[model samples]
Target: MGGNGKFSRWKISFHRAPSAAKKEPPQEFLCPISNSLMFDPAIVSSGQTFERACVDICRDLKFAPTLSDGSKPDFSTVIPNLALKKAILGWCSKTGSGHPSPPDNSEIESTIRSLSGSGGTLESPKIRVSEKELLKGVTETPPILLSHAATELNSRDLNLSSSSEESVIANSTPLLPFATRPSCFSYSSSPSTSSEFVAEEGSRNTASINSSSEDENFITKMRSLDVYEQEQAVIQLRKKTRTSEEARAALCSERLLLALKQLLNSRYTALQTNAAAAMVNLSLEKGNKVKIVRAGMVPPLIDILKSGYEESREHAAGAIFSLALEDDNKTAIGVLGALPPLLHELRSGTRRSRHDSALALYHLTLVQSNRAKVIRLGAAAALLGLLKDRDLAARVVLTVCNLAACDEGRAALLDVNAVDCLVGLLRNRAEFSSESTRENCVAALHSLSDRSLRFKGLARDTGAAEVLMDVVKADSERAREKARRILEGLRGPETAEDGEVDWEAVMKGGVTQARHRVGKSSNRNSTEF
Candidate 1:
């Protein structure tokens, strides 16, 4: 019996009817340009087979061979076969036809059933299933034997039954219930032998079971005990901050100051400018005026004022202006000697920075200890130079006039012939079109008149007297009042009766007293030129 069993197994394995061999391995083909496999096959006008089709067949066969030798099979044998030729011709004809007909509803349903499954569970809901009715007519019979009986019954009854009765019989008959029906039986319309149905059902069930088992195995492998815990640990780690205090300490440390100094010395203009401004803001907030003054920032600020970058120079001048306000910082600012540079900035810097520097100088000059130092540093000459700047010219004139109103500042300013510069600016104001310039010029002359009658004589000598007379007659009341005062100073009793201006007597009586008297009716009426 063992020998017989082995013989049977051997016969089944080796002597079984031979299946047809797969077609020959595809040919090797190359592209002319790249000398590599042709990527996509195409037919051209040439009669001979080109590289493309052969290359594609070879590429597919390289990974998966239709034959077992691991070599590309000869394509010519397959290409000439009648069945393959017919299939190829049919595909080409369908593709080349102008418009292919769409599949009928039955064909579409068959294709969907083949792909999804013959089970009613897999079938779409649009195709109705009468499960209870089908089972009721089954009569407790086996499906294969019952289907044959049903076929025989259907044929035999055709002769006796009327068409309506046949329809009723067809409706009442149940060939198979959905769950018990073999997949192949559900697809086959002809109720014949059940062997083919069993074979197809076995194949489909085998594939579905194998695929489900693989999916379950893969899902089981992917699940891990520590995954959630590890993810939570990562999130917790990200939330922790160990170096926040260290980072803040580094920013405010002396290293930051050194970095700032290096940045100020950087070759890049933008870096230098930005670092300088940042340092200025930080120092101003911290009141570290001494650090700024000692770091030689003043000279660089003056240099920046001379440069073309207006914004940098403006901020630099502003920083210096703040420093100049502090009495303790005055000596340091004076040591770096900002007055000369500030004066230069006032003369040559952008209009905004020039005005700022002028205001700073004005404040600096107010410090009695620095007043002599400013004059000695040629600040007077620098302010006189700014009289030519269109924006700052009027401002410079005004500042000088205010300084001249001070006895000591006025004395120092006069020593530099600052009066001559003022008179020159007044003479230049006549040609300007801006009313502000004209008004400022008049006001400066008025301030000068409030200083000394000699300034009044100087105003008259420079034709400022005529300019004031014009302003007095103008419609603006402020201009009129300003002009009226200057006129009285020039023609008032402060002048000698002999028509000579007594600057010495006016200086002795004080300019404020003379200004008060000039507004009086007695001084205006009784006094003569």
Candidate 2:
């Protein structure tokens, strides 16, 4: 009995012990379905046996086995779980030595029956073992079972004769029970107790799967909704207008003019034009004069007047006209360097552009500096050219009248022959039939005549006195009033009282007549040699 015990131990050691020639650890099996270390392996009635489905699953998932080659198998092209099938088939062919051929569909059942007992009774029939029990008897149970499972599945489709099956079964040996626990294999045999655990696990998986998809759908819906809302908002804003209070507020804002200047560079032409137009309209408002000058927008506007598109030039001209009505902006007009381009526009631009240019120039000349620049830029000739245009002539005449009201501007005007131009425009009544044109011309001449006694003689020599007389004969009250004032100023001292010129009589009798009478009286008082 002692020798038998020693022999049995030796046989177990020979079958179970690792070979010294094996440099790498043995391969393990993984379950194809669960993708985990195979456990609770069992032989089913369908002629198939899985020793470690869990280990086979792990191998299929590319996990390391308890005793596997250090180098990983190339799995780039391997389908998921294919490693399990390959492991199972290879294991079966090597393990089953030479047992007689089992029935094709009953190999697992027959093997189980042989291992437990051959009796046809419930107690004799083989009992299925859990993965924990199978691991207890094998040193490398995880890898061995995994390899066996992979080998079986992979070889199932291959031709295998009964003799080969017998050979494999006869050579097969049961693995001895291991002394230590298998490191890479484990199993839970506890029966499930509650439905909530299953439901919770399933819900977690479903939530994870749908999270990205749900977020994408939400973002798509929000973007579509935002696009519609933004378009509607733009349309509604366009339809709204500034209230009276808002207009007042804009007039008060120092940034209003600056903001309009910046809009001149807008990519949208319509927006640029609209902003410029709004600025022009704003400048025309009562009490908004200070805002226009203090905004430091005058220079850019003048630049626009000189070089911007047609619409911008018109708007800039209008703004200048509004600012010119104020004494402050009038002085700054020359600093604007706007006279040259303004005169050019007045002479050659479209009717609206020309008109605005003339108006702006008219306002600018009301200031001394502006009058100087006008003379420097040859505006005298430009103004003279407009004498042929009755409408332009009237505007020019009114602006000249205002300029001649100041001493410095009057001198500058006379220096540029502006008085002579006015005289010529007045005498050319054939070209100016409009009552307003003739009236403005007469008023301008009268203002010139009132500047000095010498201007009275000059006016008469230029035939301005006759033009005033013709205007006085006209039926229009304004024409007669302007013509009468011009004639009175031309009459000179006869229209003076208490060292103050009789402004009422001069306005009524015309400065031309007043200056003419003064010139005759002065000649008489001088007495010839």
Candidate 3:
């Protein structure tokens, strides 16, 4: 990862090659880059997997290859596909095929050169006029090379962190379901529901013409010189995009993204706040999340969060939270130094800022890298300090639960004697607080109990063992299950070994179970067998 703020800066060198196999390998096992068995598979940020060496070769040549699925792979960052590599090797062994070796970097480069020479060039998707018509399939190649997207974005002079991959055909499952958008955006009771009203007139107005004309009209207005015009355009765009899923998708053109990126720097407070608010609406649509980040909005948004006007800063935090919903954007967001400000927001920002920051932290903390980044930010202490504020405690507790999922987070939490804070929360079970807050507290403690050797002692010292027993009978089934496990862990292994089973009774129990379950009513069932 590079500090130049360009998103596509991950660098990994790979060199290996094997002979062509006699048998055809699975399509997915073959790197999209090499079109051969991949000795080393790596995932990129935009949810595409490729060979490690092949990605390097593309980076070396400053190429962004379009896939068979018609979408461009965001080669901003890459991670070793340990699971996929293991699966590929196992498949090779099962079929008695030789293991795939990495092709020499020179050989891969030569192949790319030949392909590009034979008309494999691509237009930048960012500036494409018919942005909506860019077919976004998951695989395939255009017979053309694309100017590396990162190069074009670097002209922004502003920069941030790198990127990575997501899914292949076989690795299509997400770790967690994106069941809801950032609820803090509208202060809605339901996670996915919006309190904002849909723009019914826009729907009726766009009934005759497609969204292209409407989108262009808005993009044109958004980039206008007049602050009054720009402000009006942003307000309209924000309002239209708020609850219109169609507007959100159709208006997410690269031109519009770039326009919004510029407006985020507006000197006028109203327009800047509107830009941030529009960003939140746009990001609610799943397709726009990664696009918004790639459009270079992150750097300016981070700037706003760090020192913008109070109202706009609130929207800025909300925008960042919304963008982080996509798993691909999580790493880049954290690597760009979002953690410290977010932690600061949790400690001092307005109520909404704290809530959105917590939500963003919750999603960002899901990955190990971000967890470690945030832990290094002294997040454990900051989050624990927020527990006293009941309004923010629910999300704060949930975010802590995410942190507890990783070993580093667990260590950090334990360092702060979080055992006492969490146990007290569980024991008190504030009458005004939501059950989920206490449930998440239990969940965090449970996660800590799993790996920390000192956790049992901490739990017993805080009277966590007794508190957990009470939670075991509480309303939340999940909380109860976790509480039961924590209680069992606190009991120690010695208790289980002390109790011995009666062999004679066990043997009788098995024979008695077989008598009723083994056969239907029959006098000679055993004789028949």
Candidate 4:
């Protein structure tokens, strides 16, 4: 009786131990479905565990989980395997590695679903993940399930027998889990919770994900394509990015801007134009301007202005115009020898390119260092030529006026016959120009004729006397005041007091017929010059 009882106890203990050990997961912790390490293992109704995302995908597909023993188990009922999840958390914390949070069963089930045939084949026509969904930060494609689907399709196409198909599926393994994927790839699991955690932690990090995903996808597409395809991709990227300010800001990374700089060098016209357009948009952010300039963008932009298509020239000039908004870029552009090409565009490019080039030079010349370079580069002739067109008169005149502030620029303008052009425009102000033009023209004359009797005489020869008298009657107080000063300087004390001519008497004499000429060597303050 004692031996019989002992034997029964021993037999019961032996049977229970093997059964429990069998139910325990392998020491390596492989997902039952994907046959990969279960980063976040979860249990389902069949009393088996798989990676959270992997098995949830399986359940969504109504696919049975293939067990370790080469048998299929029902996975209809899903539950988080808390014990396994805790283990994974512990391991990651202990190793100081970041583990991706698990996928939310409810959210995952709604956003994405796999379509598998009765024979377990995946169909074509993949559903695209929307940007809004991506921003929520929890959505990802189920690569493991997709891998299984692909294996199933391949098996079906080969006309494998049921047993052979099972063998193939069993041996197939998906790539690494999301947590283990290369740093370049990102997926959001358990989005609502992760987002809340991220928000509580600070949502600023989420903005990086937006840029990262876009940058990664763009780089991948760009690297895989030929030049023509890259051009098309660049055009599409520009189109998509232009519509979103956040996208523009997000794309303002050093790596991507360098790619754009390289694109600017492409011989393909479309690529050159599109790359210029993209740089224009990206440079809208002040921070990106410095990055773009440092990436050696100016020289290529100058190249584009020199030889690119008309639209490319316009965009490239416009990009430089935008970049020149940064003071640092202004100096850099001038140093990179951009003035010659820019001046060429101002003289001969399309109207848009001409205006854009002028705009760029306008900003670049704002730096004192660049002012001398622009004047040295012969901007005076080009600008004076454009000034004749009434539509471009104000901008051209304003830029010339600014340039004329420096001695070298004033001397350059006088040498290029800018005085005659400016005086002609001033004389025809009411017919072809605005009050601002009158003021700037007066300022240009002031800068040019202040110390040089030759420029003053040149102005007088071009009917400066009549133009100044008419300007004195102008409604703009600044214009009226400026015109009077020039008229006084042009009128000699032969009319009255030391330097004060009678303006009332001068007006009575009729400005067109008036000859108000100050002494050639008048004693006006040279310091004012």
Among all candidates shown, the one with the greatest TM-score: 3
lDDT top scorer: 3
lDDT of 2 at 495: 33
Q: What TM-scores do the predictions have?
A: 0.39, 0.44, 0.56, 0.55
What's the TM for model 1?
0.39
Alpha carbon lDDT at 254, candidate 4: 74
Ranking by lDDT: 3, 4, 2, 1
lDDT of 4 by residue, 1-529 (tens): 9999999999999867744632333454665444444655644433456665655344334455345577575443333454666776676565555664444433443333432334434342222223354334322322211111001111111111111112112211222112211011111222333223222322222333367878866665555548756765565456444324456667777777766777878776556656776676566555677888898788888888888866667677777777776777878888898888888887787655666676677778888898888777666887888888865665577689878888888888888888898888877755554555567778888777666767756765676766777777753566677777666655533433554565664555532223333322344422211
Better of 1 and 4 by TM-score: 4
lDDT of 3 by residue, 91-169 (tens): 9997779987645555776777665664435332222111122212101212121111001111110111111011111
Give each prediction's root-mean-square deviation over alpha carbons: 46.4, 49.1, 19.7, 29.5
The list of candidate 1 runs beyond 4 A from truth reads 1-259, 265-270, 283-315, 322-332, 349-356, 408-440, 450-453, 475-483, 492-529
Mind sharing the TM-score for model 4? 0.55
Candidate no. 2 TM-score: 0.44
* Whole-model alpha-carbon lDDT for candidate 1: 0.42
Model 1 residue 100 distance off true place after TM-score fit, in angstroms: 85
lDDT of 2: 0.45
TM-score leaderboard ranking: 3, 4, 2, 1
Every candidate's lDDT: 0.42, 0.45, 0.62, 0.58
Model 3 alpha-carbon miss at residue 95, Å: 34
Span of ten consecutive residues with least summed lDDT in model 2: 145-154
- Which ten-residue region of model 4 has the weakest summed lDDT? 145-154
**In candidate 1, which residue pairs clash?**
24-73, 24-74, 25-72, 25-73, 25-74, 26-72, 26-73
